[model samples]
Target chain A: MVIVVATMPIWLPATNFLTLTDGVLAGIYTLLGLSLVLLIGYTGQLALTVNVTYGLGAYTTAILTVDDKLNPWLTILIGVAINVAFALVLALPLLRLQGHFLAVATLGVALIGFTVFQAAPITGGPNGIDGVTPLSIGSLQISSDTAFAYLAWIVALLALIGCRNLISGRLGRAMQAIKGSEAAASSVGIRPFRVKMMVFVLAAVLSSVAGSLYATYTGFVSPDAFSVSFTITILVMVVVGGLRSVWGVPFGVFAILALNAALQTYGPSLIPAGGTDIPIVGYGVVLIVFLMFLPGGLASAAQRLWRSATGSGGPRRSMPEIGGAVSEESS
Target chain B: MTFLFAGLTVGAINALTGLGLLIVYNVTGVINFAQGDFVMLGAMAAILFAGANGHRAGLPLIVAVVLAVMCVSALGGILERTVLHPRRKSGPVLLLIMTVGISLVLEGVVLVITSSQSYGLRNFTPGPALSVFGGTVSLQSLWVFGVTGAALVALYLFFSRTRVGKAFRACEINPLAASLVGIRPSRYWTYAFALAAGLSALAGAVIAPVTTATYDMGLALTLSGFVAWVLGGLVSPVGVVVGGVGLGVAQGMVNGYLPLGLVAYANAFPFVILIAVLVVRPNGIIRSLAERRV
Candidate 1:
């Protein structure tokens, strides 16, 4: 892996571009991943509806800019509104379902979203809503790579702050309480259902906002972009980053993307004629290895190293793992 | 009338898929996401065999179906012992992810081995059409309906009449208690997996003539089965069949009666029903009736 990173520029022209472009992509995905961490990791809810919310954001921005002739700034707000409303409708009932059933239910939402985008003529069917006008100020278009990178960073930073505040505040405590035990939480007047629904909805709205900006930034929207694969990728990011550690998300995103990039660049040399397909094997192996060894994720690994370096002698508290269970059944 | 016959034919296939899903769900208590992949592999294997062994005029369709089922069941057993057994102690979510990972590996391997082109499993042509209930029906449709009905009846008898079947039921109801009573739950898991894979393979072999084999078809079918499972309340065989057929007919009806805008919603019907039922009744439509049994 180190050798691949060292020799990257020799093979991938995107190597220099990757340091910049990949960084931006990491930031964007981190935003989404952190939202998922808050939802699934801290709140003890399993939601596979991220892609649907994302598509809704993209569609909203596309429609507003292309059909309604609304400004890009206004489109962003509309995107958030649409996403929140959709999440509200879904969360009202979906929050009640737990475990595999909840996962299936959210998966249904995503599948239905995919079907709507692919089959409905108004949404351009499989062709998708394309030709979205790029977000711009009156005199200067926010079309350059540097500009868009900054835009993504700003949004990601705000989202990070929002998530951090939510996690540390009274609401965050209530959410953690709910995660620990819903019955106990409600007994203490936390209103676990409503709080969970609120967090889920907020997560959806944030993801949608990111999606809208992404569509406008990329100037394209396709059903292919918002697949179950994308949802899984986001979930993997949170799991690989150490859920509940807000600072770990970017590392998680970067780790996976870097691994993917490395496989794409140097995998062919390692296995003759394997080509780009080796990453398929790489991701699976990485997931299994991480799940077995580093269940707390890369952040946890870094924390261990830092603690050792500082010679802090206190016994470390075992991080409360919310959903992971080695037993056949998990609540 | 022809479309109704077509719908019925597809409905029978859905029944087979539902049956395959139920067997695994009953014994192992894991909703195998790779079920559709097994179906796809079965069809592909049969297609390859037919190409290599010659699609002879005298070869029986039953023989081809049996071969497909046997091969796929063996594959299921291999997968269960190798990947699933190690992760037997994991939570359902982790197991779910493992199955998905297994699915990803299977898809990549299949794509590399098989060409991207679709293949025809042409041996199962029940030649000629006949009149049935004021509609033109093919022998193929009749064969599918008959086979699925027979399979279900056989399954019902086996579950009720055989000691192994009784053991399987005991495992499903309560694995801990079943183990106390000397039933090997792990062995049951392998057996149930084999049963599900075999049935899925048979369904694939039957439907391959109508729909060609594609690498990614399994994922969608698996998702639909999940929707059916949710709609049917997960544990009831009768409810599963009803839900599966109802979903098929619902999609068919939307295709038949709706306008273009609404017809596009046909594919989304299962998901829409799923979300609705989840919101309205999380336990599914039969939850109230089956509360005591469950």
Candidate 2:
């Protein structure tokens, strides 16, 4: 799968389907989606900071490169560190909240981040900073769309493998245990707060990486680009693709992005002009449909099919529970 | 002083939104994110029926308000029955996400209907701004206060004096035990949602004259209302009312006193309060919800 995605630019014609820019966006959004999966899917902390950290990364890159003329590569490291610090500080108060309270508190965090992006002078005060310097090696300039596409995908795939490995070991078990029940996990000697905080910060770092790449690739950073709507869009992507499946996260992102692009191309004709909300409605309906019908998402469906094909029909595994009211179980 | 009055008016509306949130949350344990959109829908529908700016001949103000409130209440019940009923067994997190989905759909449908146009409503009662306590208060602000105060009293009475309301409290305590006593929590879910929708619709209708009806306003309203709800500690109805008023007054002061160049940051005030309160006291300013229940 990695090989197919990485080498697609060589063979696939840009004339018809996804262009280089869209693929680059996919790579960036893939990181954000994976962060969501790790935090919400694996850890069960409904802290919505994907777009916040992503914005931090974009702003960090945009500010450093445009204002201070710092090296773009160096800014990415600084952006990740900043996002990590932010996540650590926020997770302290947020991890104490349970279920719905935690979710809304995260929303509050998202809104505050948005305000700072729009109001702060350093962010150019809603006009946003433009004229970002492009990234380059000692000799190789990453100015072309195709080169950035490779750079983004290579980094994305590496992160993907890193996340896959990180969540598959003892730490992964601890996370799943916390997701199931904090009391039980604590009884077993896993500090729920530490585990949750670790995953949250890690997710923020991943999102920061995406944000940095996005700013340099787009060559501009704006508050409009980091609206709360995008955060929900990413949530829908993570949920629709597969919540717990690491490899399945991109499938959700690409599928929804393709759907959205298709809508933009064809929606005006079918729905009439000024029907921009059609795509939004599409996202919301897609989220509800996938959650109700296939909560495990495409990955679990594929896993079930694969097992049936192999003639060893495994007993159905229960859906991984998140932090919320266990109304049915408690009752 | 004028800023204080303005804050109180906005606070009343925020309280109404928070009240709507508390109703559904207390009865069903689901935070209906669509509550603000309900307020938005009511305002938009009323604007459409009563005619924007009172230039176009349309339904009378009373009739228009009733129609909008009734329609939104019905829609809320229908949504609860159709979209949320099947997911009743699902965990609360999924239910919360589902409300978010519902919010998106409502906002989108509203955007389609309104064509992203802002509608201004003529005040429900025709009058000049009244001078009270050295501050000029608009007549519409009085209407907003009247409506919110009436709602608070009615709800207090309903919860304390009516069997149905106590049944709601009963379910809040333990739905299973309530069910054992032949009280169906599922039935209350739809009713609570409908009631919440109606309450917010009334709030939006009354407040629309001051804040024009717009498609994108729902998100702000949701943010403000949620902040108020959290400030009340998510436990007490009366606490939520006080929470909403305090938040409103604080926001008003922030807006009034900020330098001309920095007033734009006041929009972020509620969010800052929300994060601060969530970090400092997730419960609320009032420590014990049990002692202060409506």
Candidate 3:
């Protein structure tokens, strides 16, 4: 499946379906969605700052390459480091908050990032920093849309593998334990805070990587791309695709981006003038419907159908226990 | 002195919004992320009913404001009944995300309806600025402070003096116990949602003249209100009011003294203060109810 997706740019256009650019976007969304899966699905932490971290990476690469004359590739590492450091700083205070409190706090962090992006002269303000230098190794440049699509998918695949490996290990168990019950996990020597912090940083790092790739591919970095709405869009993808499944990340990402792309192409004609907002309404409806009817998302729904077909009986593991109610649980 | 007045006005708005959040949170155990959107709805609806930009057949300002409040309250009630009430058993995270979805939908609907144009309400009272302590303050600002104070007093009386208020408090204290006592938690939850929406609309209508109304304003207001709630420790109503005022003043100071380039970052001051408070006093300046458990 990964190979087929990676090679989609070569054949997708033959059927006039999706393009290399669409593939690039899907790859970016996959990275972003997987990051959310790490925190929301595995650690049971609700964060709205993924886009802020993504912006950090994009801006880091954009500023370093444009203003400091640094290599694009080197800027990626620096961006990731900065994002991890920022995440650590943020998580130290934020991890103490539970449930909706944490979500709102993260939203505050994202808003602050946005304000800085728009205000700081170094960030180029709302005009944004364009003419971003693309990634190059020696004389070989990954500037073309096709090449960038391949590059993004390759990185995305690597991230998926890394996430899967992380989730299957002792660290993953610690995350699950913390998600299940922090006090119980602590009693068993799981160090919930440390584990949660690690997962938070890992998610931030992934987001930063995706952000850097996005800037490199588009040759532009704008604050608009990292707004709170963008964070919500990524969230919609993660929840719609399925929260716990690594394989579902691509599907979710593709589903949302394809819908958005389709909407952009056909929405205006269908909705008439000044009704471009119909797609946004569609996104909200999709999110609400999915949460209400399919809490575990499409992946879980698929699993349930498969189980029924195979003559499996007993209770299904459709809904994972909600993790953000730690405070209520303690009470 | 100017900063003080500015801060007071902003703080009053924040406090009102925060109180709305606390009211719903206390009863439902769910944070309505749509709280700020209620403010937006109130302001926008008022603008539409009152009409703007040479549009005639506009209702009187008071009537428009009342109708807007009622409309937004109905929205809150409908949202509670249709979307949230059924999922009362879900976790806080899911509920919070659902509110976010609702907010998105509201924003989109408002954007479509208003065509994304901003609207301003006529000030409740038309008067000249009064000079005090080397600062000139508008009569509208005075009205804002007065209205906020009155609302707080009314809310206090409602909670402490009324049976329904006591029932609401009971629901917050322990839903199970409240249910056992024949107090239906769902009824209070619905009331809380409506009350919260009405309160937020009041704030929105009051502040609309100063801040103007836009479809996108809710998210920012919500964040600011949340910061104020955190700063107050999410406990005492008075504490949140103070927190909101302090935050507003601090932002005003930052705007006044900070360099032009840094002025944009003033919006982030509430967040920074929130983080600092969380680190130093995780429970806030006033101890939270959860902390009082001991």
Give the winner by DockQ.
2
TM-score of each: 0.88, 0.96, 0.94
Q: What are the per-residue Cα lDDT tens digits for candidate 1 across A1-331?
A: 3343334334334654356556557667877887788887677677888888888888888877887888878888888998888888878778888766787778888888887777766666678777788888788898876677667777887787788888888988898888777988899999988899889888988888888888888777888888877887787777678665676776778778888888778877886556667666666556655555565677778778887899885656543332132231354
Candidate 3 ranges with C-alpha deviation above 4 Å: A14-18, A318-331, B286-294
How many steric overlaps are in each model, in order?
0, 0, 0
Residue by residue across A167-203, what tens digits does model 3's lDDT show?
Answer: 8889988987887789999999999989999999999
Candidate 1 accuracy as lDDT: 0.74
Write down the worst ten-residue block by lDDT for model 1 chain B.
Answer: B51-60
Off-target runs (Cα >4 Å) in candidate 2 are A10-17, A318-331, B287-294
Q: How high is the lDDT of residue B272 in model 1? A: 80
Sort order, lDDT high to low: 2, 3, 1
Interface RMSD for each candidate model?
3.2, 2.8, 3.4
Query: Which ranges of candidate 1 are over 4 A from the true structure?
Result: A1-19, A243-245, A263-289, A292-294, A303-318, A321-329, B52-64, B286-294
TM-score of chain B of 2: 0.96
Query: After TM-score superposition, what is the CA distance of residue A328 in candidate 2 from its true location, in Å?
Result: 9.2
